[model samples]
Structure formats: C-alpha cells, structure tokens
Target: MAMSNAGNDYPLSEVPPEARKGLASLAMVLLGFTFFTATMFAGGKLGVAFGFADLLLVIALGNLLLGLYAAALGHIACRSGLNSVLMGRFAFGERGSKLCDLILGFTQIGWYAWGTATAAVVLGKYFGLEQGAVLALMAVFGLGFCATAYIGYRGLEILSWIAVPAMALLLILSMSVTTAKAGGLAGLLAIQPSSSLDLSTAITLVFGTFVSGATQATNWTRFARSTRVAVLASLIGFFIGNGLMVLIGAYGAIVYQQPDVVEVLMLQGFATAALAMLLLNIWSTQDNTIYNFAVAGCNLVRTDRRKTVTLAGALIGTALAVLGMYDLLVPYLVLLGTVIPPIGGVIVADFWLRHRGRYPLLAEARLPHYNWPGLAAYGLGTIAAFGSPWVAPLVGIGVAALAYGVFNGLTRGRTTAPASL
Candidate 1:
C-alpha cells in the first residue's frame, strides 16, 4: 500500500521505496541486543550487590527467557511498518500513544547520555585525564551523536554497519582474553558465583533483560521487507548475538574478578578496541532510539517526520552530554527498565487475544481517536510494574495485561479497529 499522509503518519509505510536493504535490516535486529548486553553486565554488577550465588542464577535464567520473548517482538515491527511506540496507538488511542512515546523517548535519551558519559570516562581514565576532563570529553561525543541523528535514519544505518561488527569483535576478544586469563573454559567454569538465585528473581532478571532487548525491535523491524526476514534476523540477534554477549559478560565476573574488566582485556588485545567498541555500541543503539522518536512524531503531527525526529534527537542528545547527567539517568534507567516488560506483555496479549490473526490496528482511519480502554490498560500496566520490591519494574506490565483482559472481556463488544500503516 502506498503511504497516505492524509491520516496518521508512520514510518513503516513512509519509508521510501528503496531505503531498505539486507544489511540495514539485520542491523535493526542487533540494535536492541547491543543495549541488552550492556544492561546484563550492569545488572550482574548490581547482582553482586545482592551477594548470593543462587540469586545470580535466577536472574540469569529470567534474563534468558525475557530474551526469547524479545526476539519475537521483531514479528510485530516487521509485519507492521509502525515503530514500536506508535504501534501502541491502536491499543492506547492516539493521545495515549503519546505517553508511550514520551516515556520510551526519555529512556532513549538516558541511554544516549549514559553511553556517551561511559565512553568519555573510559577514554579519560585510559589517558589518565582528570574528572573535569572526562565530562568535557563526553560533551564532544554527545554532540557527534546529535549530529549523526540529525542526518536521519539513513545515516544511523551506516553508523550501525560500523558499530555492529566492532562490538562483536570486542565481545569475542573479551571472551578469549577472559578464558585465557582464567586458564581456559574449564578453569572459568570451576569458579562459582557467590550469589544465590530464587526462581522468581531469576525469572524477573531473565525477562527484564529480554524486554530490554525488545524495546528496539519495532524500530528496526519497520525496515524489514518481509515478516520472515524480520523473524529470522531477530532470532539471530536473540539467540546468537545476545547469547554470546551475556555468556561472556556473566562469565567475565568469574574469570576477570570484575565484569567491567572486559574492557581492560580489550585494551590489551589491541590498543583502543575497548574505546572503539564502546563508542560504536552506543552509536548503534542511540540511532535506533532516535528513529523511533521520529516515527512518534509522524504519528502525532503531519509535518516532515525526519525533521521532527532529528530535532528530538538533537535536544535529548545535548542534554545527555551535559555534566552530571549520568548520575541522574541511572534511577530513570531502572524505572524505564521496569516500564518496558509490561508493554511486551500487552503487545503479546493484544496480538494473541484481541486480534487473532487479524490486525485490527493497521487501519488508522478506522481506529477511534481516543481509546480509553487502551489508555486505562496502559496506565494499569505501568502501575502494576511499580509495585514489586525485588522486581517492581515488572509490576506495571503484569497488572496492565490482566486489567486489559478483564476490561476488554467484560465489555465484550467494542469493535476497535487497528491503525493502518
């Protein structure tokens, strides 16, 4: 179908006739995986704070399951050209969709800021620069990200080509060095985690990590030419890319005595690989996030989608580069981490229960401008994600699903039409 600008606009239908390519398509699948690997490593560091071997196991298992679910998210994005955030519109109403966009967009900003800051610090420490100098360095990188984002998704796709391979090599190199340092795989296996794992916590971590990876699937899937390609690419990302990154990251804790030390090993393998990987990884991830924001704008306004997305990226990227943004971004990151899973739950439930092989959401003109049920369910999900102590983040998602199901069932008769791409 030709893209119609007369109604609600979205990129899945707006992408020019020739912008799609196999490499660019595959990069979309890897985008979320990159962020996920970073989170798993960070989560492992946090797991260390808990101090129980069993807990780590539980978390690892939870993250694994979540990863599987995330891998499947590509089906939605690729099948529908709608970016993930905009996909919510059919379920949440156009206005309600804005909430999803705002939250996800902010989370992306945090990722960009945290990543740029991290790279700056890594570089600064390596060069023996002072704290003040590190902040300055991050500012420079942040500007570069903004500049690239402003050029649009095409530019981002090119950046991803460079980043994905670099990150893969860094991951491989880290695993090799860590194994060698620990006296090989056998020796690394012998070293045990000091943390304990309960089934619930483990499940939460596994799912948490999975949702984390999935958040970007829709953005990339929007470019996929076919559902089969999208699903296959996503499987590779979930099973191959993420599997290796986590296996290496988690094992790094045992072998290197510090997971973050993976970078140290990278530095040793070839000078600057660590820094290069860090920069490229963040660049790859940030561009996808920026693309989603652009799509969100297309949904909200009739103006040029690319320009709006670029403006959003520039503003968010610059804010993230400013001093002390990382410290503030951490809590929000955790909140975003929690907020995402419920969305996956709703997406899965909506696809399975409400649509049942028919995408009611693909026809924008037929959709109600305001879907209170969707809005209510979305709010309930966020609230649910907020309640748990150990995994309060998931509360919103779990609760939202149940609430939506119950509400939709009781009503039993609203023929909500899907948004058309």
Candidate 2:
C-alpha cells in the first residue's frame, strides 16, 4: 500500500518528506515532553530533601545523561523516519517488536492516567471540589486531550506552543514570590536541607522523572529534517525544560516548604495562576501521553487506527484515574524508568553498530519474527536493572548494549538487504 501521514501517524512506514519538520517544531514538541507534571513532582522531592547546590548538580547530571539517551534514539528515528515501535521491528524483529509496542503502549497509558488524576487532585484541592466532581474533571481533561491527539502531531505542536510558555511563566512567578518572601537565593543556599537524599537515589529519581518518555522520543524526533535537529531537540527538552521544572520545585521547597507547584502558587496568592498552570502543565504531558499510547497501539494492532486508539486510550486512562489508579500507577512509571531505557540501548547499538547510519525501507525489508539476540540482551538488561541497587538504568543500558554488540559481532551482523545495496 502507498503510504502517507494521512490517518496512519506513520506507524508502519517512514514519515514522508513532505511531512518532515524542522528544528524549531521538533524542539517545541520535545520541549512539551519535559513539561510533564511528574518532573515537577520529582523536583519537589529533590527540593525538600537536598540542599539547592546538591540538587542542581544531580538534576543537571541526570538530565544530561537522559539527553544523550534520547538523542541517540532520536538520531536513529530521523535517519530511519521510524518511531520506536517500528524501529523495534528491525532490532527486536517483526512479531517480537510487539513486545516493545506493549511495553511502550502500556507505560504511556499509565502516564496518561497519572497526569489526569494528578490534575484532577490538584484542581479538586484548589476548588474545594471532591469525589465525583474530581472524576468528572478527569473525564473532561481526558476527553479534551483525546481531541488534541485525535488531530495527531499537529495538535500536539499547537498545544505545546501555548502551554509551555504559560507554564514556564507561572513556575517563574511562584519561584520569584517564594524566594522573595523566604529571603533570597543566598538564603536558600545557606539554609540546610531538612534531611538528605542519598546521591544514588536522588539521581535515580532524576532519571525516573522522564526516563520512560525519553525512550519514545522518536515519536517526536522522527519528524526532524536531519539527525542534528533530532539530537538538538532532545537536549533542549531534557536539559533546559526538565531542569527548569526541577528548579521550580527546589526553589519552592526550600523557601516555602511546599513542593507541590499548584500549592506553591496558591500560597503565593496566585490562585488564578495556579489553576491555569496546573491545567496547562498537566495538559501538556497528558496530551503527549495519549498521543504516544495511540502511536504504539497503532503499531501493536497492525492498523492505522491512531485516532481511534487515541480515544480508546484516553477513555481507559480516564476510567483508571477516576478509580484511583494513579496512586498505584506511579510506581510503574518509576519501574519503567529503569526498564524501558534498555530498549533504547539495544536500538542505539543496533543502529550505530549494525546498520552504520542507514536501514532498508521498513516495508520492503525482509525481517525476522524476533531478533533473538536483541531480545536476549533486553531481558538481561531488565534483570540487571532490577538486580542492581545503583544506577539501574545506566547498568541496564551498558549490559544490553554489550550483549547486543557481542551477539551481532558473533553473527557477522546480518541484515535483510543485499550486501552491495
């Protein structure tokens, strides 16, 4: 079948040139990826537990590592014009790739639920609303996002342009007000933390902030016109956008002893701003979560049901959030932080080592049902992540990359394409 963006969301084919985007649009979309409420939540934890100086060091270092991980997969996405799930068909094999689809898809659904429920909870607190009212708000947020995702990438881009700047402004406002009232930057630095978060655990939380979403960056980066654009988009998103979120949480925590962003704004006499920020901030992540779910579901089902799958995911997530699934769902997001990056590890190794910057057209490529070596490495990586107490994501990536490289090296790096092609 002839392929185009159409209703397909490019699940099974390269994104056509006409649909390819530039650095700015890709950056905008990637920036939205970091504007998630979870980053703020993680930041709040860091702020309360660690001194400002220590928190800065960990957040910067952690995000840089995440940036590199996202950039590597992003480079592959742009070069191949394939999202993570389709790329998995090559690295993990055709049928085997569905595992990636399921993992990626399931995680995104969990994220959507968390974002929706969190927003509902925050809004409920602000409005003194409760129970059924909060559930209705979840449905409202979920369905609203479902419409955005139903329109696909363009919708995400448009929404980000509005939400990112608004959220950032509110974060700055809360930080400024809190800092002034509590003393200042020097005072914040001078004040000792209430306690200490272990360096390893703090770093883990840092990684866990966006590690799951980082794996699926190709969903946005595949629109990049070049590999450099893809990498730049990711670095800007993870390093700057994510770091700012941490700063907001850290500042508010240190100064006001409040880590919840909405609470911080409300306490600062910005009730209107707090509500606006909460709605938009959580909406930014919420839309992308459902969008990512739709893309993965399309790949999983072997159809171009992006919009249908998107709406279905929103409904599922909204239902879960109303049922109080987010309290339980958050841990899965944290678990995925460590487990999901191994997929990127295998992908980076496969793209850089095996294909050497290029791959045959996905549709015409003769691929196996499962690339056993890749699957084996992924399993080892997951186990290693669980087995290790420190630097779990990094350890998983290293183990997976080495195991993948070794297996392929032993096999002479076979591919479906003819050698001379």
Candidate 3:
C-alpha cells in the first residue's frame, strides 16, 4: 500500500533528517505534555499519606525511574526516526502491528475522554453551570482541544511554547502560597499524615500515573536531532516537569488538604489564575493525547488521513466523556499501568536485541504477518505484571524483555529474517 504523508505527520514512514528538531523545542513540547493535572492528583494522594520528607523521596525515585524508561525509548525513537507505532511494524510485524495500534490508540482516546470530561466538569463547577451546560461544554471542549493536534507537530510545538511557561508560573505561585500558609518548611515537617500507605504503593502510584504517556512520548522524541537531545528532553519532561507537578500537588494536599492545583489556587483567592491554569493544563495535554490517537489510528488502518481520524477520535472521546469518563479515572489508570509498559518493553527488546539497534526503513522492509515471539512475550509480561504484588509497570517491562530474549533465541534459524524491498 502506498502511504501518504500529507498532513499525516509521517505516520507510516521514518521522519526525514531535515525535519529533526533541537533539544529546546523537543524538551519544551514534552514538558508541556507532562505538566498534567492527573499527575498532580496522584501526587496529592501520596502527599496525604506520607510525610513531606518521605513524599519527596518517593517523588524523586518514581520520577527518576519514569524518566529513565522514557529516555531509553526516546533513544530508540531518535535513532529510528519513527514513533512506537511505526516501530511496532518491525517488532510485531506487518499485520501483527495492528495489535499495537489498537492498544496504543485505545489508551490515547481514553486519555482524551478523561481530559475532556475533566475540563467540562471542572469548568462547569467553577462557573456554576447546570448539568446540561456541563455536557455541552464537554462537547465544545472535546472538539476544540483537538485543534492543535489536527495541525500536527508544528501545532503541538507552538501551543507548548506558550502553555509551558504560563503553567510553570501558575504552579510556582500556588506552591509559594501553600508554603506561606503552612508556615514554611518547618511547619510542613510538623504536619502528620491522616492516611497510611506503604512506600512501594506510593512509588507505584507516582510511576504508574504517567507510564502510558512516557511510553507514547516517542511520538515527539523521534523528532530529536540527536540521541542526547532525546534522552535529555525525556528526563527534563518526565523527571523535572512531572516532578514539579507531583510536588505542587503534594504541597497543596499537605497545606489545604486538596490535591488539585486549580482548587488550591481557588482556595488561595486566585480564582482567575485557577481558571487560566485549568485551561492551559488540560489543553496542552489534551492536544498531545489526541495527536497520539491520530498517529496510531493512521497506522491501524494503513491510511494517511490523520486529520480525519483526529476528528473522528475527538467525537468518540466526546461521547465517552459525556458518558462519565471522569468517574472512571482510577480504574482506567490501573488498566493503563498494567497493559502499556510491556509494549514498550517488547519494542525496546526487538530494536536492540533482535535488530541489533538498527531497523531498515519501513517503506523498504518486507516483514512477516505475525511475530509470535513478540506477541507471546507481551502476553507473558502482562500476566506477570498483573499478578505481581510489587510495582507492576517495572515487572511488566523486565519480564517482557527477558521473555522476548528467550523466545527470540529459541526461534532463531527456524524462522526467516525480514527481507528488504
């Protein structure tokens, strides 16, 4: 099938060298993606459960692990000039790649639905709007949020440049107020936890909160001009940016017993700032989420109509949002943590171990229909993760990679290697 690149953001092909981006642009875009409200909420949960010192440690360790995972994938993406979905063709094979498309595409749309619902519900409460008005707002915001995604990479970059700084300022302002109210670092140390949670669970919450996003971050990292840029940008975004979000949430929770930054701002008499923060926070991530959906959708159907798929996805997300995606956040997040990380594990193992860190161009590579080793490895990994009592995402990645290595070794010399077109 001949693939089209018009307004499609190279969904089926490697990004050309001339189109690669510098570190600053890529980092800013990723930072914008990571400055999410849900992450803050997760931090808020940890904040209430652990003391300030312990909370910081958990945040550090969790975000550090998340950052390392993203950096590894970013390295692969930078080298290949293809995102996870495109890379799936090599690991999962030609027809088997659709499994990745479905999994990734479904998760992105789920996120889109949750974000749309969150925007509508939060805005509605703040404005004293009726339930009908809230649903209408969901429809409006759901479609509106896809505007940047519809325009593709340049659109995401422009929006990020504007939103990242504004969000940083708002977060700093809220944290400063929270500190003053809590009587500074000394007073924060004096506070006692109202809840009990183990260190392992706290770390899992932090890591799982954004593992899906980290996995999909290759969508932007593939644009990096060099591997160093990719790795650094991944750390900046997943570590620094996500860490800040978690810190702010924890701070607010400890000070005001609220995990949401926007609500914390409202409590601090910054109603206007809260509104601005809400819009910027949700819009930035929403666009990126839908953009991810479009990329996966394009690959799923083997089509180049990204804009069309984006619109269709927006509608589907809107319908889901209206149907109550907001209330489903906890279960949805749990599902994401279990299922998403193993896909990345398989991709990494396939790229580095099977292909020896190099992949033939997608257009010129003739691959098999089903790579059973990859699929079976993914299943084994997912089962291990779901059954493990420890951190599920980490288990999923490790088991998946190890299983892939074993399977690939056993299958070597029995199956034919992929051919060049």
Q: Sorted on TM-score, highest at the top, how do the candidates line up?
A: 3, 2, 1
Estimate, for each residue in 1-421, the C-alpha lDDT of model 1 and write its tens digit.
2333312223534343254446444645365335443654744543443433444454455555544565556676665555666567666655666667667766766766776677787788778999888877877777666555565555665676667766766677666766687787566545655766555555555556546546656666556777677766665666555555555556556655555633546545655666666666666666555555565555555344555565666566656666567778777777677777666667656655666533644544355666666667767777767767666545666676787787778766455544444
lDDT of 2 by residue, 1-421 (tens): 4544465567667887778899889888878778876677778788878777788898899888888888888888988888998889878998999999989999999888888888877878767996889889988887886676788888888988998888877777767778788678787778887877898888887876788888898998998888899999989998888878877777777777776777777787888887887788877777888889988998899887677888899999989888888899888777777788889889888877877767888878889888988999899998998898898888888899999999888888566663211
Off by over 4 Å in 3: 1-6, 413-421
Which 10 consecutive residues of model 3 have the lowest summed lDDT? 412-421
Worst 10 residues of 2 by lDDT: 412-421
Off by over 4 Å in 2: 1-4, 418-421
lDDT of 3 by residue, 109-150 (tens): 888899899888888988899999999999999999999999
TM-score of 2: 0.95
RMSD in Å for model 1: 4.2
Write out the backbone clash pairs for model 2: none
TM-score of each: 0.82, 0.95, 0.96
Candidates 1 and 3 compared by TM-score, better number: 3
